[model samples]
Target: MYKLGYRNNNCIGCVKGGAGYWNKIRVDFPEVFKQRCKQSRAIGARLVRDSNGNRIFLDELSPDAGKYPDEPDFQCGFMCEIISKENNL
Candidate 1:
């Protein structure tokens, strides 16, 4: 099971769930987030974001477009960092 938390900034509310909860920690503590991302990537899982600004989980990426887990090292940290920074986290 995952835990959830609410973070308010600029009148917007952010709900944390699963790894998403880590975002709060990531803001309060960045080094930890980097380490976690590194570890997750090493294990072949990745965090991604969609056009809707939602985080996407990837265990593997396939050119065939079939359902499969995406690799964690597949540039998740980079995207996460970008989003976090852009969003002023």
Candidate 2:
């Protein structure tokens, strides 16, 4: 995603994203959302866990429902930092 212009490594249609975020993704990056849904089904998993304890697949999410998940407002550091730390680099 960083290579695609996103600042962070968050997955496409991140499960953590709330309704507003997903809605925006649905509007702005429909193809990504669709692909994520397809991949999720292939893996037999969904990204979203609803309050009702139901696994709400991305395909089943209501475009108008869901709240944007809170995220840090700043970005710096590359994903390599995490990889290096794990490898004791």
Candidate 3:
């Protein structure tokens, strides 16, 4: 992702992200964000959750939703190299 100007390796629009992350995607990669929103609706699945425990579509996140919590960095080779054989089972 850093190669494409994105600082993290998270998916284009990771489902685990919070409002702050979604909002950032809206500003930085509007097209990709839009695609995820549309696809999510078509499949009846959403990546965001609102304060009321309701699903908040990617397109509906508020501008100042919240701040992204700091996290440690990890690397993945796209191979399950980081996982253990026991965990895979």
Task: Please tell me which predicted candidate would have the highest lDDT against the true structure.
Answer: 3
Return the clash pairs for model 3, or none: none
lDDT of 1 by residue, 1-89 (tens): 11223332211112222343344445555675566566657774555444355655432212232221221212234666677889897
lDDT against the true structure, each candidate = 0.41, 0.65, 0.67
- Backbone clash total for model 1 is 10
Off by over 4 Å in 1: 1-19, 47-89
In order of lDDT, best first, we have 3, 2, 1
Ten contiguous residues minimizing lDDT sum, candidate 1: 66-75
Error of 3 at 10 (Å): 1.9
Sequence-dependent TM-score of model 3 = 0.63
Can you list the residue pairs that collide in candidate 1? 44-72, 45-72, 46-72, 58-70, 59-69, 59-70, 59-71, 60-69, 60-70, 60-71
Task: State, as a TM-score between 0 and 1, how close model 2 is to the true structure.
Answer: 0.57
Candidate 1 vs candidate 2: the lDDT winner is: 2
Model 2 bad stretches (over 4 Å): 1-11, 69-89
Candidate 1 to truth, TM: 0.33
What's the distance in Å from true for residue 75, model 1? Answer: 28
Query: What is the Cα-based lDDT of residue 56 in candidate 2?
Result: 76
Candidate 3: tens digits of C-alpha lDDT, residues 3-83:
554556755676656676677777788898889889888887877767676887776777777555442333444343434
Cα deviation of 85 in candidate 3 (Å)?
18
